[model samples]
Target: MMNSLKHITCAFALAALLALPQFAPAAEAADQPQRPILSVDGRGTANTEPDMATVAVGITTYATDAGKAQNDNAWVAGEIQKAIAQLGIADKDIQTRNYSFRPTYRQDKGHENEINGYTVDNTVIVTVRDVKLTGKVIDAALSHGANEISSLDFSASNTQGVRKEALRSAVNDARDKANVIASALGKKIVGVQNVSESTGYLETRRFAGNMMLAMAKDVETPVAPGSLSLSANVHIDFILSD
Candidate 1:
């Protein structure tokens, strides 16, 4: 009777050990998932003419007295504002960006340590709707009291349409590249698994030199708002079908 009981316990233990391997496969299947077939990146570009421009203008005034410097700066700023108004620019379009007072530095003599004068700086930003009037507005600002011209940038006022076009181009580029790869591998593209898009901005540069700035001086300054190019990139993952 004792030998029979021991033999029965050993047989049950062997059966449990055989069943454990079957359960391991179910756990492994739950942990693992399918992976993608192919991945690629594509780029596209589109060019268009800019419709708007931004102008940065300013004045720098210096005097021995602090009050004099402040008065000069205020006067110049007023004149600049008047000029912008004369150009028919909206009041909201003109923005004051900076105002500051700094002591002028003198060097190279026995009195080099002394402060020579007080200087005041006032800067303004102006947005122009008409590209043709960009030069005219800049000239007007300078004639009024703006002595220094900082920067002029041009860009598209409405960029939504162009951005959509660029995105479409990028998608097409990705598809074309995937087709070529599939053909080389003797396989067909089944579908897209993932896609992502990125964009690039267009910028315009300003030239530096001595120029004339008088309201009555009606000589149109040759302003060339060059073409702007926007770019887009798309990363795609494609599944291959045999």
Candidate 2:
């Protein structure tokens, strides 16, 4: 009986020792301290002069015959295209933005259900590589039978450099904010755990309403290709240390 009791006691001790590894890791993890983290958002902007411009011009014509209306519109559109070409605009730079051919309804009581005439509208978007030639492009279009001007917008041809600068500025801003917050909490940023960024640029738009008036007065349409603002926003996860 004594020998059997000794063997039973030894077996119990061995079993307890074999089970220790499973629970040991959990206890060790519970005792370890967690690292601190700081999250911040930053924004930055860079301004640059516009190098390119886009102009949208339209031509409208009406006639009793649809064929005649379409023919007149095509003639005027061709003339405007030629005029734009004279100013050095390439064929690829000119694109038809919109075109429509529809019959107009007579508003008179007896003719209410009758078709009065056919109207044709043609709109084209012209990309001006030279910002200085924007006004000339508009004037050429108007002089060649373009009756409506929809929009004029300005942008920079090369924004990659500007965008990089803006991103750098945004990262610096985030670092500065993190340092401020960490310092107040009696801690310091040791490393960046993760970072994300988004970038965009805003275009400068010119009013098209006064363009015809300016042309009527026989003065050069004044255009200002103002500065473009490129912006970047960043979200950073900074590791903190005491």
Candidate 3:
């Protein structure tokens, strides 16, 4: 009986310990203070002379027969390619962008457009290493029967390097603005809380009315590739203190 009583008492003690209520970790205090912050956006632009120029030359030919049209276009395109090569452009820089053989249609009285002849257009995009050679390169292609300038653009070769400079300027601009605002409010900026950057791009302008050079005489074509603008935007949050 004594042994039985001792075992029963031990089991009751173990059951009492297991029945205690459990509690979860406490969450953040509800009355905590939020740090005062100043949010600002800054924009900066850096301009650099472009080192490269992109131009597209197109050869268009028309003939009654499709084969003749293709042949003429191919011959002119080959000549234009040779001309560009003579202008010191690398073979890799010359890329074929478009080739199309389509039937030309003429409007007939009270009828659907009638097929008059076959037309073939072959175009190539060329990147000029030197901006000064843009005019000469176009003139060379024109002399070889390239009649169309589809697209033209100029851009800085070292865009990333230029962009880095722009980003630094933007950050500096943000800090300056923050300092001005903080001084006005009689508060001082203590620390940086967060920073973010937007997607930046290079802005290049097109060469306007440049195709008219094909009609001019032996004069060297004048091309002015204006400065290229590299821009960046930054958003910053800074802590404010009294």
Candidate with top TM-score is 2
lDDT of 3 by residue, 1-242 (tens): 99999999999998878765332222344355667899999988877889999988878999988899999998898899999899899999998877889998877775557788999988889999998899898888878898777667898878887888899999999999999999999999999999999747888767635544443344666678888888899999999994
Clashing pairs in 2: none
lDDT (tens digit, per residue) of candidate 1 on 1-242: 99999999999999999999999999998998754488889888878889888888878999999899999998888888888888888989888888889998788688787888899988888888888888888778766777776777788877777777888899889889889988998888888888888987665645444432432245555678888878999999998884
TM-score of each: 0.76, 0.81, 0.80
lDDT of 2 by residue, 210-233 (tens): 754665356577777778888999
lDDT of 1 at 65: 91
How high is the CA lDDT of each candidate model?
0.82, 0.88, 0.84
**Considering only N, C-alpha and C atoms within 3 Å, which residue pairs clash in candidate 1?**
none
Best-to-worst TM-score order: 2, 3, 1
Off by over 4 Å in 1: 1-36, 202-219
Model 3 lowest lDDT segment of ten: 21-30
Q: 2 or 3, which is superior by TM-score?
A: 2
In terms of lDDT, model 2 sits at: 0.88
